[model samples]
Target chain A: MDPARRLGPAQIDVVAQLGVSTVLLGGIYALVSVGLTLIFGIMRVVNFAHGEFLMLGMYVAFWAYTLLALDPYVVLFVSIPLFFGIGVLTYVLVMRGVIHASHNVQIFTTVGLSTALQNAALVAWTGDYRTVRPWHSAVVIRALGMAFNLSQVVAFAIAVALTLVLFAFMKWTHTGRVMRATAQDHDAATLMGIDTDKVYRLTFAIGIACVGAAGVLVSPLYAAYPTAGLQFVLLAYVVVVLGGLGDMLGAMLGSLIVAAVEVVGSYFFGVAWKEVFYFVLFIAVLVLRPAGLFGQRGAETLGV
Target chain B: MPALAPGRWVAVALFGIVALVPAGVRDAYLLDSVILILLWGALSAAWNVAGGYAGQVSLGHAAFFGIGAYSAALMTARFQQSPWLGLMLGVALSIVAGGVIGYLSNRLRGPYFALSTIAFSQVLLIVASRWRGFTAGSEGIPVPFRPGFWTLGLGHVAWVYLALGVAVLYYGVAIWLETSRVGYQLAGVREDEDAAEALGIASRRLKVYAVTLSAAMTSVVGTFWAQYVGFVDPFYVFSIDLSVRFALNTIIGGIGTGLGPFLGSLLITSLETYLRATFSGMKTGFAGIYLVIYGTALILVVRFVPEGLTGLAARLRVRSSRAHA
Candidate 1:
């Protein structure tokens, strides 16, 4: 009757399944956090409405699927572009005014934006949870003697592909270089005749587009609701900070770490405590390394 | 700090009207709305202590509010203890929680600090919901209705007075802090932490004090809210929407001013009531249309009237004075 004897092969298999699932879940988180990191990197403004944007993406996919009979995967093109345009409009109309404002103004402006978007969605769509469960939504694929949701696997693949594409774009594109330079030193970038304002607008758009993409990918697996963004955005913040604020690769890595912690910790402490676990981790990371695991020194002090 | 100013008399007159007007109004709906306005006014003022004066925008104040509520509700429901005692305990616990949050987050400026606070509250919320043995889970704890003086039951009129008293107490504290040397140091910290540190002000300690004071007051307001509703639930009390509403009221009324939070609460509550009445007939989605308007108004206020209604009033006064000259 030794407690150690109770640990069996079945339990180990369960743990292994959890690990694989965590990695897949982390890919989706990485996709969401990457854009958040990019926006924060270039412009020091934390978009509190970032989650709302994801919610918008989900709704877009949901509606397109429901109305146009489009697949969730196919709706990414429309959602991404729509969200990009919305992002650009937000930057132009709202965020631009507060770029030079005080921290209080900046924080509340975005907070206000988040409130408006969330409530407007609630008003427009009601609080009903809508999901697009196309065929193959529940298909299970066995890989390496483990079962995986086919939809989740596809979403994971898309997430990784998008991240790679973004990395390449940032590396090879002139616009990406300009964004990095602006993020490094706004004054210096402007001195070099780079349009920092345009860079900021684009960075915000791209950041939002990333979340929009995530929304489309997630619609098959999850329900879309007005407050859905609130749930994901918190985890995105955790991922962004854990990876190091404004560090792209760090965010991707951080997402996996957070996902692992979430899955493994939930197994031990029950599912309800998962959010508590990550939030504690977030505070600990913030206290121990405010610059984040991959962020540059003194990044935490920027734009504060 | 002047004596017998015309503005002071007007304020005194306004206070007198608010305190005595409830006695004449017998409509339950009107009384309830007034009570809510007073409650929100106190809550927003409490938030303004750390947010407006100290310049640390906390997006997770619902933690302290929920803590205060749950403590009072649980104590009253389980132990049959007086809610007043529970209120005191809640205040103490919230101050401690505030100190912890401040100590952990004071190093972080702006949005980082705000997010940390949100995370902290979210942790508390999860604990509140999961620890069903203590909090009754999401079903929430209900305070047994006892019509007695010790239970602080004195009818709706009495409740109005109680809420008004708390709001006045918060207003008095805010005014005092505004004029005190500590207030100046907090303002310094808000304006620029580095500059404040260089001026020999201990920014961390000061911020902790500000947050603690704010939490203490916020907890009291939570206790009142729980008592008013006769229930306490994790989602109802610890909601991020509640936290956002606190900030919205303060910002709309005028942050860092004595009358700002109160005025903001009055305007917002009235608008909410009016909108609910008008839009209640709509079948779907109309429930939150008021909130949409509120949100848009909040954005507009932040964008154009950063100083809030008080600032706008001051501007008008200066304009008239110059025109007369």
Candidate 2:
């Protein structure tokens, strides 16, 4: 390779260091996008408010940390159920009505929910970034002459394990099978007495629970703020669309691709140029493969 | 031209009262609050076109508003050009930009379209912040009034009323658009794009027109904003809060109805003004509480009275007519 394109010894070491970190980041993104995709698949409604749920969970963890001095990890027991209840309540109160409302209503209600949640956080937390500081120094493991952080490794493990469980539940379990049935054909499921409302409520709850879990898992790695979820929200959208909306595996792959793009682009060009590359990637993918790389046919098109 | 509706006459009367507000109110603070209400009302009304009319909810309309404000600020601050001309140029640019983005995303679904608009707006914001030479970065560039009859001055009651007049004009135009044939087509497209397209409505073209026209109107307000404050900052100009507030106004008032934004703006903006004045130091928290209320209100409205205040009124009017019959 040319000197410019080729990796020197120092550069090679840096690349090796970054490689595992990027993959770990990408794994967390996959986890995020899977939650989003599951909701989209079941309801055929894009939950624009998905990110706010993550914010809400982080805040839950924040309060748990501040008020009770609970370790953020320990608070997951509370966060998951609380967030799940909120999610189910959202479906019952808002999403049910919107499911039958026009496409505008769907977007409007969810966006409203997102805005309201974000502002509520802003008003409550005052836009400050918070973190439950790591219990130990940021430690790294060396394998095959490459290094990865303990935090990243733990997050990556949790993410992968949760994804596997989700995949298995969806494939093997009865409720999961019903959920998949409803996702594939809502009217058919209704005809078969599959209880779609329950599915929707459960699916949304599960989605929220997953994000809440991810929030606690990653809080040690990064700071939490009122608007901290905005970046991830945007990234999740890219992943879902790139992974092919409503495709679980596609979302996982798309997450990797997006993380790779952002990290590599940031490395090669600069941080500012990362978004430019993502935008170009988004447009190109949209033009060439509208259904996304692994997307189902007729799945990506607008309904109304 | 069609005569104004008899019911709208009441609205006109309310406007008449508002028009005399500066004259009746001597306190500058009161006048300033009144001006803010009118400005928000105008901005919300403009937002209703693309969002309420065409059913493409743009969560980043502040981008147009910001661009327009900055364009006018730059023009008048640098070249000493007449602000009225600057306002026109700003509107032109906003229209062009809105058209391009609207056209690009016209085919996509709602959430994707919304994301694209946000992406565009965010990119603009990033550029504005980073390109400090032009935008003055975070410090912001202030423009002092070189007051003339038409230079768009600050610290003047007349200019406030003038801005109010321009806003009223825009509100009227938006109302007119809502009742027009193009308006019908846009609404049809919004309701069912394929159905509208099947009927030869040219949904994409109409969407582009609606988006562009709304952008132009919003940009006009942006220019007025620059003149009112006599300063341009990226933070205030490009904030997502502005877009959220605009959406809140439209939804609360009566989305899809001509008079919805008017009532929504009036009610919501006044509520915001009251909150700001009452809760001096805890403003952020207060604002958050207000958002929670606003969103709760929106969800409730969508659930029960999705047509909003205007829809409720229409129902009342029909009920009374039937009772009389």
Candidate 3:
């Protein structure tokens, strides 16, 4: 390589540092967007409260850490099951009616739920920004001239591992197959004696559980606040849409792309500029590729 | 004009009563609440044009609202111009922005369109908060309390009248839309886009028109809000909560009916005001008590009465009529 073309060691370090942070950010984003995409893919209903669920998870973990002196990661065990039940109850009470209702109803119902949940949290927590300080949170892991927190690294590991597990379950498990069948064709799945309603409820439960898990993992990384989910949720939308709505693989890829754009864009244009770029990209994607990168032809206009 | 429906008559009565609120209630606090109702009612009505009639369901309307508020705020504070000129500028800019947004999102439906509006609004929010040099950022721009006809008003009563006038204008627009041919076409577009397009309704054009008109009306009210508040903050103007509030007011009242948003705004804003006053001294969880009720009401309303309060009233009236028959 020409000496002029070759990057200096410091420049290489910067690139690697950005790359690692991007993946770390992408991992959490992927975790969130995966659940959102799955919900949309299976139920064709967007969970506007996905981030709130994550916030709830963060709160749970925060509480667990504060009251019981438990490690934040241990709360994952508590959150997954708790959020799964909450998810099932949500579907039964709320989503069931709107599953067949108008798009506006579906959208508003969830938006209402989100507003209620967010405000309820605000009421409960007093809009305070609570942080989870795991013992390992301060430990910096340095490798190859890059530095990151142990908690963040662990969060990234759990995120990627859970994503694999989700992929495997979808590929191998019977419930996953049924969910996929329901996603592919609701009527056909019903005609095949697949118990499509059960599949939908299960899909919603799993999606919520995934986000809940992500939220617990996120507790140590981000501050827990009532509106904390707002930022993540919008970013999740961008990632989900960029990857193609309702596409798991696309969500993962979109997460990386979006994180890269944000990280690199932030490096150059400042923090606010990064948001502007992503939002513009979000609109661009919607306008130009409504079906998303990995989505089916009719996914964007599903149930229209 | 179309034959006066029961809802239309009720709306007229509602506005008439609301117009005289300042006369009966002399308390500044009470007047402030009424002004909030009228301002929000007007905004909800404006949002209803595109969201209700054309079925756009924008969650990004704060961008336009901010555009108007800041345009006037910046003009009055920075350029030393009359707010009326700012109003004209704001409307023109809002029109262009609305047209662009409507055109861009012409083909989007449901959640996709809603999300796009949010993204668009977020962009504005970020810009407003970040561009400190241009917008004064979150510290906000203070509009001098220049009390005159050119300044837009003199006292609390004058504001109530001003707000009432704007609200009535929005109501008139909604009535016109419901009665006009363009309104019918917009309705057609909302109901079934493909079918409406097949009928040569020019769906895209009508949708854009609805959004453009909606944006203009919203911006006009934005100017009034800026002047009324005498301070303009990016957070207050460009927040998603404001956008969602518009939708919530419309949906809770009765989207597509044109008269629903005002009713919705009246009920919801009153409830919010009452709740805030009741919980003003509370702490912790009580801090968001008003929002909790507001959100729960929204959920319960959407779930049980998707047609909204007006729709429920209409239904009740129909049942009574059937019983009599």
* Candidate 2 lDDT, A3-94, residue by residue in tens: 97566777787787667667888899988788898998788788878888877777777678778888766777777788788888988877
TM-score of each model, in listed order: 0.97, 0.92, 0.97
- In model 3 chain B, the worst 10-residue window by lDDT is B283-292
**TM-score per model (chain B):** 0.96, 0.91, 0.96
| CA error at residue A140 for candidate 2, angstroms | 3.4
Worst 10 residues of 2 chain B by lDDT: B279-288
Quantify how close model 2 is to the true structure by its C-alpha RMSD in Å: 2.7
Candidate 3 DockQ, CA atoms? 0.66
Residue pairs clashing in model 3 are A123-B285
DockQ of 1: 0.73
i-RMS values of the candidates, in order?
1.5, 2.5, 1.8
TM-score of 3: 0.97
**Candidate 3 C-alpha lDDT tens digits along B1-325:** 6688888789889888877787789999988888888899999999999898888888899988998998888888999888999999999999999998898667577888888889988998888888899998879899887779796756989988988988888888888888889888888888898999999989988888889898998999999899898989888799888898999999889987768888888888888878777887777568577777777777788889989988898899899999999
Name the docking class for model 3: medium
- For model 2 chain A, the run of ten residues with the poorest summed lDDT: A295-304
